[model samples]
Target: MTTQTPPVLALDVGGTKLAAGILTADDMLQQRAEVPTLAQEGSAEAILGRLIGLARDVIAAAPERPRAVGVASAGQIDPRQGDVVFATDNLPGWTGLALGRRLAEALDLPVFVENDVNAFALAEAQLGAGRGYHHQVLLAVGTGVGGGIVVDGKLYSGSMGRGGEIGHVCIVPGGRPCTCGQIGCLESYAGMRVMLPASGYPSLRALADDYLAGKSIPAVDEAAHWLGHGLAQAAHVLGPEVLLVGGSIGLLGERFLADVRLSYAVAAIKSYRNIPIVPTQLGADSGLLGAGVYARQRSGD
Candidate 1:
């Protein structure tokens, strides 16, 4: 007789929100709960307490108790130690946090932690858009742009787990300043924080809506163009089989993707120009699901 694997708890901590869910052995998510992060309003400890409370709420609604916990967080995470190596002001007081150890102790469960974008890439490669591909690149363009690289069907987290920081790649030398203390980085031009204000749209969704309605929004177009330029550079260095675009802005659908493709074609070398760029299949759940899957795989469960 075969024994069924137990469900695992998945947590995603972003600058704007905290989420928790129960992921079954079969990869289905249940009892999902979310709360605003309000990162700037309180100390990290208070935010952690809120996350812990969210986790407990989900666990209470789950059909079975989870055996382990996995966290996908916005930061440069040390996968080995499950701590934050670095973080931008988006997640205030997040750097150098011993996240895994704290969660493990609080819930009395083994825990694993990974950068949120890396987790998103893992989920896409394993079960979403990049499925069946051995190598791929994923770019997440939301509040801030981030990236993840998957080589040989596994996440290539680079030295100290800081690889795949494509958003920090310099696209325009001596241009706009970025949050990472760099000038002309892709995020400075393409991220929502910049695009939304520049486009005079109250939100990314509104900008996308206008673009989709045949309204020409110069800011959105400019962001897409720069994003494509960044992708082309990434492609030249890491010739992946495919590129997956995720996050809120990326999901602007075919119209925005067409613009990015046009820019990519112009910027990329001829040999690398044919690579397919597609939307992520899992939508908003990629990070949460990926964290759960990573925990299960790493724990040998």
Candidate 2:
């Protein structure tokens, strides 16, 4: 008789979307489902219930029901305790939610939780852009800006679990206020939510299309400047072998990459100009795949 690897169920909670899937031990995701997260319309309990409902839907859709669950959430997470230690207003009522305990109890399965960006970096270290490099950085520019670092093959969560949070790095002094209670953060300038509106465009898709068509997009250029400056700072400090950009905004296609690289070339120190700044190979599935990786690793404990 042959024993097969069990499947892991993964969930990702964002301000705008909730996604779930069953991941095989081999890192393939199946039976994926996604839905909008209407944070303002519900209490913490109601939102949690909705998340669980989505999980159940994916579970039912999966070919093999999974017994272990992993969650990657957008907020400050206490991975050791499997709790959401704190969440800013970006995710209403997500703070202090004991996600691991709550889900473990509700579904009668082993659960693990991680900061979403950290999870993304973990997956990158395992099989994505950071595959061979021991020092890597991941920057995600989207609805919210997020970042993660891999040092010596491990996720670097500094004190307060905010290590490698490049989004909050102040790029402009006395600049716009950041959600993290700071001013002039990289996110303030480079985040899609901010850049899109500042672009005066209907949407990022439109802005990206125009940019790809070789049209002059002043707002996009400005945002690229901010992004490059931030990456320059990270390169100066971390000396990462590669800097990978991901998330909705980062994947705006090759033009975005080229623009950021051009800016980075000028802003970065001459010695560091050779570093490759590329888009994440894992794309949208990184968080889900990473969640599954964490779930399988922790379930046996």
Candidate 3:
């Protein structure tokens, strides 16, 4: 008789989209799917129902039943306790929700919940760009900027489970207001909400199209300057061995990268220099795969 190995179910709930996949013990995705998140629905139960339905669909498509589930959602997460302390504007009515217990009960298995960005970082650290490294930082610069830290090949959750809120770290104190109600956060400028217009295009994808058409936006370059400055500050604090740049905005052409690197260099203190900023290897599927891995690790399944 042959013993069958169980796959891990990975689910990622973002403000804009929902993605799920089945992951093998070797970190390979055996199946994947995605859907839009209609957050306007306005109720934790309703939204959770939608997410659960989508996850079930993905699970059904898997070649074999998964033994454990991992979920990645946008906003703050308390991984230690498995509670979603706050999901912010993306997921309304998510604060103080016992997400872990609810999902575990619903699925009849262990469920691990994590911040989407942090999960992205964890995936990259273990199976993607940061592989073989002991210390790394995963920075996803998209509609917002968030980071994940990996020390000694494990996630550094920090005190109070607020370790990776790099986007909230003040960069231009009292400059631009952020979604977190803070002023001059990195997300205010580097995030897609700001960079899209700054790139002189309607959106990040549009900017890519325009760049291909040889009509680059000067404002995009300016945004890159600010992004670089924020990254420099991050570099100063974490001193990570490698920085993986993920998210839709990172797809911006090398021109933007040049200015961002320049700004980072200029803003960085002398003590921290020469940190390599590279692109993500997992691409758009980072969050889903990360969720699977996180669940597998947390559940010991």
Candidate 4:
């Protein structure tokens, strides 16, 4: 009798980049490739065509043919129907896209679509920062802020599939507006887009440079404050055992981490006095890894 091969293939479709990889059961990538995402094409067909090209490249380099594919994209997805139901700020033409079915048809393999932040959280829970914890919260602060929750090692996508939207959590009641049409969302202030301007930088790497120059401390402090306020509210609701921070803002290191914790303590109710906050071990690749793992699990391989 012949033994069955393992399932592999993961793609991360981001606003700025598209990453594809072939993974093994051991949580390692067998092949990988990355390219820019030129989202100006303005339609799912165009974007997905580019993604399919990238996938083909990885498939060619893989040691063996992958049995399945998983995609982690920035948006709200209807898992039951495998549809991209809403647009995330990152990708412009993602709303109402039949991403799962389309990909499965094109690749001739099963495909899974998951929210990018949820994929990051799953990476943390199963292989990274939250590996040992059954319940954890992942906060991704980058071009925009996103969040994910893992309960008992399983992703809780909530009703409406927008439950982990921690970035949209109102902190200041009537402050800055978010792309999600909400005011006072934490993303309006703490996200990389917000911090870059405050730090007098034209880009994220420049902001990091400004921080190293010692002039961006105030900007960092401001980010931490907004993030803490939002997290305090999250603590009240999800109450995860650990809070794992990822994305561009997390690169701020110890200085911002301290302020985030301090502000959270003040904003949080008494019940969340001791929840641990830490950085994600999977870092930038968390989303990709999580997508692969989710696909493999769903495939039962």
Candidate 5:
């Protein structure tokens, strides 16, 4: 008789929200719950308390006790130590937090942490749009832009676990200032923080609504163009088999993706222009699922 593997608990910590779920032995996410992060409060303890509460809420609904916990967070993470090496102001007071150790102590379970975008890429590569592809890249365009890379069916987090930071890629030399204290980065142009204001809309949903309703928003087009340029640069460097676009902005649907593709065609070399680019299949749950899967793997469960 074979013993069953226990489910894994997963949490995703973003600047805007905190989410928790259970990845069942059958590989489905269950007992999902989320709440606004309210990061502007600038209290790491408060945020962590909320995360722990959310995790417990989900665990109460799980069919079986989870074997471990996995966290996906928005920052440059030291996966070995489960520490946040750096974070933008979006997640104030997040840097230097010993997230993994704290969570392990709080939950009394083994805990693993990874950059949220890297976790998203892991899910996409193993179970979502990047499935069946050994080499792929994922760009998540939302309040900020982030990226993850998978090589030979494994996530390739670079030295210090900051490899797939595609958002910081320079698309324009000395252009707009970015939140990361850099100039001319792809995120400065394509991220929602810039695009929303440039579009003269109060919110990203409003801008997306107008664009999807056939209103030709120049700001949207411009952001897409820059995003394409960033992708072109990635193509030139990594030459991945597929490119996956996720995050709220990336979900603006086919029309926006067409615009990005057009700009990519203009920027990429002829030989690299034909690589397939697609949207992420896992949608909002990618980070949660990825975190769970990563924990399961790391824990040898």
Candidate 6:
């Protein structure tokens, strides 16, 4: 008989896509799958049904049935209570959802729910860019500029999972509209959805190529300016030893980090400029991997 625990099922839900995988006790991803979120789909229940079905398919792909499940969702999730307090239009009708209990009942196994960005931070802190650092901060600039904070090598979600929401920080102060119904948030200024088009670039890769070739794109530079300011502000409060940038627009935080550093030097206090900002090692799969590890740990397995 094998003493090793059965693999855990990990699900990562984002505005653009949904991904699922089976993670072994050793942190190996055994089976994985993906699908478009198509958030236009009328209701949260309807979308969740699709994800549940997709999760089932991936779970079966593995040799053994997973004993637990962990979900990383893009919203204001209360991990301690296993519910969603609020969500942006990114995931319509996601507010006040009892995702943890619902999934536990449906899957017949223990379930853990986490904010997607927090999950990313946890994964990076353990296995990626933030490794070897006592404190780390992760800024995921995908559809929006989501952030996660790790303090003293541990995930830091404030009392109600509201600790590391760096995306909503008001950098522009009425400059751009945010999905959170706020004006001039970091998301408004740096989110790829708004920043990419504003800069006249079709994609982050295109922007990266142009910037790497020593060309100046208004949109990219503008984003860096805001991001640097945001980072500087975060540095004062969080005091992390290392900072990581990730998500689709990151492109290894290549040209972006350089520009950010330039701005950060001007905005942050003299001493705070010493913080090292780097690219995330786990680009797209941080949430998936983190969900698995988090579930296993929280479940006491």
Where model 2 places Cα greater than 4 Å from the true spot, the runs are 1-4, 57-67, 299-301
The TM-scores of all predictions, comma-separated, are 0.93, 0.88, 0.89, 0.91, 0.92, 0.89
Cα deviation of 285 in candidate 3 (Å)?
1.4
Weakest 10 consecutive residues, lDDT, candidate 6? Answer: 247-256
lDDT of 1 by residue, 1-301 (tens): 7778899999999888999998887778999889999988857887899999999888888888999998999889998879999887778888999999999888889999999999999999988999899999999998889999999988889877978999999999999999888899999989998998998988777777778889998998999899999999999999999998889986478899999999999999999999999999898888899899788877886
lDDT for model 4 comes to 0.83
lDDT tens string, model 3, 48-148?
88778877887778788898899888878888767887777678788888888888888787788888888889899888888887888877887788889
Cα distance off (Å), candidate 4, residue 76: 2.2
**How many clashes (backbone N, Cα, C below 3 Å) per candidate?**
0, 0, 1, 0, 0, 1
Instruction: State the lDDT of candidate 4 residue by residue for 1-301, as single tens digits.
Output: 6564675899998888999998787678767889888887666677888899899888888878898898888878876556899875458778999889988988888998898889888888999989789988888988889999999888888875667888888887889877789898889889887777777767777666666566646777888888888888888898889998888776677767888999999999887969998888887788789999878767875
For model 6, name the residue pairs that clash: 199-219
Per-residue lDDT tens digits for candidate 2, residues 1-301, read 6766789999998777889999886678898999888887756777788889999888888888797999989888988767888886667878888888999888888888989999998888777888888898889888668899888877788875768889989999999998779999999999877888888889878877877888887878888888999999999999999998888875468887888999999999999999999888787888887788778767762
Evaluate all candidate structures by whole-model CA lDDT and list the values in order. 0.90, 0.85, 0.80, 0.83, 0.90, 0.84
lDDT of 3: 0.80
* Model 2, C-alpha of 101: deviation from truth (Å): 1.1
Task: Evaluate residue 269 in candidate 2 and report its C-alpha lDDT on the 0 to 100 scale.
Answer: 97
